[model samples]
Target chain A: MAELTDTAQQRATGLLRDYGAAVRAKRIRAAMYFVALVICVLAASWSGEVDLRKFVEGLPRFGSYFRDITPTLRPATLGSDIAEWYWNFPVWLELLLETLLVAYVGTLAGATLGFFLCFFTSANISGNRTVSFVVKRALEFCRTVPDIVFALLFVFAIGLGPVPGVLAIAIHTAGALGKQFAEVIENIDLKPVEGLRSTGANWVDQIQFAVLPQVTSNFASYVLLRFEINVRGATVMGFVGAGGIGKELLGSIRQFYYSDVSAILLMIIATVVVIDLLTERLRHRLLGTAKV
Target chain B: MKPRIAEPCDIDRLRTAYPSAFAPGYARRAAALAGISAVVGLFIFGVVWLGFSPSALVQGISKLGVILKLMFPPTAGQHMLVYLQALAQTLSIALLGTMLAALVAFPLSFLAARNVVGRWLLRFLTKRVFDAIRGIDTLVWALIFINVVGLGPFAGILAVAMSDVGAFGKLFSEAIETASPKPVEGVLSTGASKIQEVRFAIVPQVLPLLLSQVLYYFESNIRSATVIGIVGAGGIGLYLSNEIGQQSWDHVSFIILMILITVAIIDAVSGRLRRSIIGAQARS
Candidate 1:
């Protein structure tokens, strides 16, 4: 009985020793992370010249604005003429359509460009390593810059219009979709392509017979997904004078037209809902997972 | 019998058995597609001719080079304090927004998950809600909230929260869907309640992934928050835009540098945190 008790105690000690080591490692990691975060915050604060006093001063203004919004949302003027002016159906509908068109055109253009690049960038599909590397790096650079910055640059280049917005969205989408497409291509079953190659098919023929078929559905799904994203992006591109519903929204806000703002929000929400439903159905159908 | 001279009937049977080798159908389809491509090519040429000038592109590139020259040797001068404050505000907005979205999404994601919800209609509705929200960019949400709340960090926070709710919900649901079912089943077999099954089994399985995603979003939100600020939701983006509007290209460069450094640091830290969490899970 004494020997058994000693054995049990020794085993418990061993377990505790292992647990202690894990705990210590965890603590050290946590401390290192904390230190890193602090260093980053300090560096940013120093570089940006952030003042604590100004932040404190600004806090009250924020409070006042929040307070104003609550009373402004009250429905006391529901039946008033002002409400009618704010919620004009034709204006809202026109803006919504413009936004949708920008998103649609952008997605189509982006997907087309991206699909071409995907083959060149994909190591599994590209005939040469050097071409794949260059294409992949180009895509990475394209995607690294935020879409809004791209919009700003395009607006500067093309002059202000929905054209700039469309172009910006297209460029960003191409980068993002290209990367996703390449990944999809990389993960595809290579047997089919190999078999085509064995039959003396050239690169283009092999891709057409094997690679394209496997990824077509996925590509379609991503395009639809990008369209949905572009819709939202196109809406706000107007703030930079890139024309859309966002321009109207911005104008309304500047004029303090609260009722108009509410109307626009409702319109946007409704449009988004419709698009969401359509895409979901399309995805399910394309993926062949639709339930009987 | 086979050594006898091949008859015309036997040759016909062989040709019919392998139609692909002898068929004209594939060639005809390829020719039709080529015709369609020609039409598309003409349409593209028409549009390009209508919309743009090649000389204008050359002029624009030269102008871009001049603008880029003005941006070099970034100056952090008199307005440094203002820029810093705005940067801090952006960080706070990102942090608050990410936290709010993560907290809200953690519960809603379960409802969106097909495995967790079990009811197809309910799950479908929740999922669609996420998609609709996500379909709209964070900038749009910022614009909406700027209208609602009146141009400040508060609006920025709300926008980030709203957009992240959609994104986090989708991501979290995907993670939940991909989690190991064995643990959930084990809990269920032990007479655990549905909620308990999720709590004891599903949550643990997906928590690390969910945390990592949330952290990544936080880093992404920092960049997004800056962009929204350009539209007057209050952040360094507003300052950056202002500087650009004034053609203070030096200051614009300075702000860009600040953003780059901040983003890089956040990315590194978050990446480390993700690795550590994954490691812990592996050890367990």
Candidate 2:
């Protein structure tokens, strides 16, 4: 009877100890999260000029603004040359085509450049450390500057047209795709290249026969993906006066022509959907997963 | 039979094995591959066609040098306060927009994932919706929102949110599809409903990935907020563009510096947080 009582006492202590440890852990986690939340709130308030009073005062304005937006779907003014506005359809279509053309050329150029640069950029393949460092930094600098800034600068330098937009997109794509391509190259199996090297093949010959074949499918898929992104980018180049559908969209917004804006948006959405579908199909085919 | 003298047959075999060393086709293939070097020629042609003369560059460099001479030590005059205010606005816009997008995209991701939805048509349509939204750049989305909501940070917020919705949906769905199926199967076998299974199993598996992606997008959205500000969506970008337009190169340099510093800080913090989250998930 005495031993049985002792065993029960030990069991009770162990259970309590386990419960205490769990509670302590839970408290620590909760405190850490609470501290983090406080920091976030403080940082946001400090950086965003957020003040309760100002926000409260602005609430009514928000309501009035919603009221102002009620007549958003205004019909075309009865006598106001709807025909002239309707003529914009052809122009919009042409602009859409131009956007596609720019994306195509840019993607092709960028992919070609990126493919070659991948060899030099890959740490395993590079001949010299200095060369790799310079190439990597150059790509970083190219990508760090947003594409819009590039478009703006190109517009200033090259004068207005789709040329600047294409060049801008190409430069950006080269930077982005070059990094991705280098990663793909680095991840490739080295056995094939080693086999070629053991056969007394030169470095260039080894890369050509072994490395290129292994990564071609992945490289193709990346290029297709970049092309899809570039299509969207090309459409927006018009905002900087580099040229595309964005110009018309900007015009509609400036004039407050809601219907026309809607039409242009519809066109853009449709174009994007079609391109996306095509890319999906192409990617599957290139990856040899067509049956799947 | 082997005792008969073998005169350098190994070398002879090696030479015979790769006869392409002497073949013209080997050189032709090399040339074709190396043809990419011709891009330099195209670059030169573009320079000439675009009238980018070396002299013009040199002249512009001198002009830029003169401008740099004035932008000394970054003036913290009366406009400093205004600059800080605008910077804060930009950060808030990015934060609010990212939060909104994350909230919406987190649940939608499960519906969009092929493995979760278990229907090709639903998956395809859901993915297409994401694609359509993402296919329009943030700047264009800003323009659309500006028309709908009028000009302000509110418009910028909406624009960023809309653009991110597509991106987040895609990223989240990919994460869901990649999650381990074991826990999900176990939960389902316990007579749990589909929703319960997903809630108890898949959510835990994907939560860390979703958080990391959301954090990354937030870092990115900060940069994007600046861009949309150029279109009068009310952020530091508006000030930056105005400075550029006014040819205040000094102010432009200062603003660019601010952007760089802010982005760097956010990236470092988010990177640490992401790693910790991932580490915890791995441990669990």
Candidate 3:
């Protein structure tokens, strides 16, 4: 300690002082943030009319919903006869299957349309910036307007049914997937596109021979992801008279049929889980093959 | 990335070089074509199944044109202030719900993390719980909550929070699992308790990423709150749906404008914040 240089010791104290100041500043900032957040929370609780007392009282009511939702399993009927637990299981399954098909058709149509539009939107691909901007904005508008809203409009125009639901889901999907697919296109290795173009290839040939190969796997992955989301969207589109199990679910809720509500919800949850699993596997397979 | 055809080769030369391929010898191409045709066929079937009528579409468009003409001179009508209030409520619902989700999920995220949770079974169960929660859409949750709480923004808030709990739990836990252990180990080496190590090391590392994700969701939830409102939960969406039903095209257009503006503003603000957060992380 005696051998330490005077400047070195001075430097050490200065560093310590700076560190203390920084820590103090950070603490002050953190405290202010906490206070601000608390105030915001309190204000929102009031504005949103969140009554903690009422919530606590209604907590059991919420719990009862889940209890009702759970299938009853008597000892005698445990696995051998599950009728009472799910009386409308077969009909609900068909409606749920219809829901799945709606999502599938919507996703397929949307992704294909998006595939064409994304090229025009991608900065790296489009030749005309004005066209690109318009296309991008159109896609944004398509997505920004909720599928339910679109469903409502179409229901008004074309009458209430599955067509409106499918159209709504498709437009929403195109809006979302076009943006994502464009990003994928922009991120691709430009060397291939440049190579193809230098070889006297037209735009179509370049996209087909070079760009498509690079992006098809990713495009497929995004489409699958969109399909998963569309399933959820299609479920709710029925609230606006668009067709699917959502129509029945809404009807059940409207009529206060607690048993049917639970039954329909169970089927929806099951369908979502199964679709997620199936799509996850498909994405993995596509990516795995692409990698190889 | 493999080039499908050798570059610098003429189209004619390529065709001559691969005559059999030109006649559809490539299984991949044939399969792709088949898939495309099938998709097109399915689209046609879906249209037919929908009982699509061109005449109806044309009639609908003309009706829509009348609405659009009325909508041109957009007026807020007598409910301008009411519309504004509803919009604010939607924003609040989104904000409050997102924060609530973050608060609930923060601690549970640790339990869900594979690195933090000791037992594989516990982690697996936690993950599945998150998945199940996330499986039910916010609109469904909104409908369910409306049943319990009656109706209003309260239901919307709860719906958003519940769905976000599932999402944030999964995302936050995954972020925690991906965090490097060196800093945690360093903190522990100073005789710190497990809690102290986590508080000092892990939280600092993952908080930014978690918050950015939460922020992004907050923006999207604004749109969701509106959608859920259509189900009678509460928000401007209820008003929008009402106007649409009554064929008050002007009010509907006004509501649409407000929502679009609100969403655009939120998207821009959140985008900047996300960038700044990423920049800070990069610098540090």
Question: Residue-wise lDDT of candidate 3 within B1-284, one digit each (tens)?
Answer: 88776677576788898887677557887898998899788777767765667887788778767777988777789999999988888888998889988899999899899767789988889888999899888988998888778789888898999999999999999999999999988998999987897899899999889879998999989989887779887778899889999988888889998999999999998899888877778788
Q: Which portions of model 1 show Cα errors greater than 4 Å?
A: A1-87, A125-134, A189-210, A289-292, B1-15, B18-92, B108-136, B143-154, B177-199, B249-265, B279-283
Clashing pairs in 2: A47-B88
lDDT for each residue of candidate 1 in A214-246, tens digit (9 for 90 to 100): 888888888888787677777788888876788
- What overall lDDT goes with each candidate model? 0.79, 0.78, 0.87
As for TM-score, the candidate ahead, 1 or 2, is 2
DockQ of 3: 0.56
Q: What TM-score is obtained for chain B in each of the predicted models?
A: 0.84, 0.86, 0.87
The number of the candidate with the highest TM-score is 3
Model 2 per-residue lDDT tens digits across residues B1-284: 57665467666776678887645787777886676556446544544443445675565446556666765655534578888888888888888778779989888888898778988888888888898788778997787666656677777877898899999999999999998899988998999998998899999899888988888899989988877888988689888777767767677767877876788788899899999989988887
Q: What TM-score would each prediction reach against the true structure?
A: 0.74, 0.76, 0.92
TM-score of chain A of 1: 0.86
Worst 10 residues of 3 chain B by lDDT: B43-52
| Candidate 1 residue pairs in clash (backbone atoms < 3 Å) | A48-B84, A50-B84, A50-B85
How well docked is model 1, in DockQ terms? 0.19
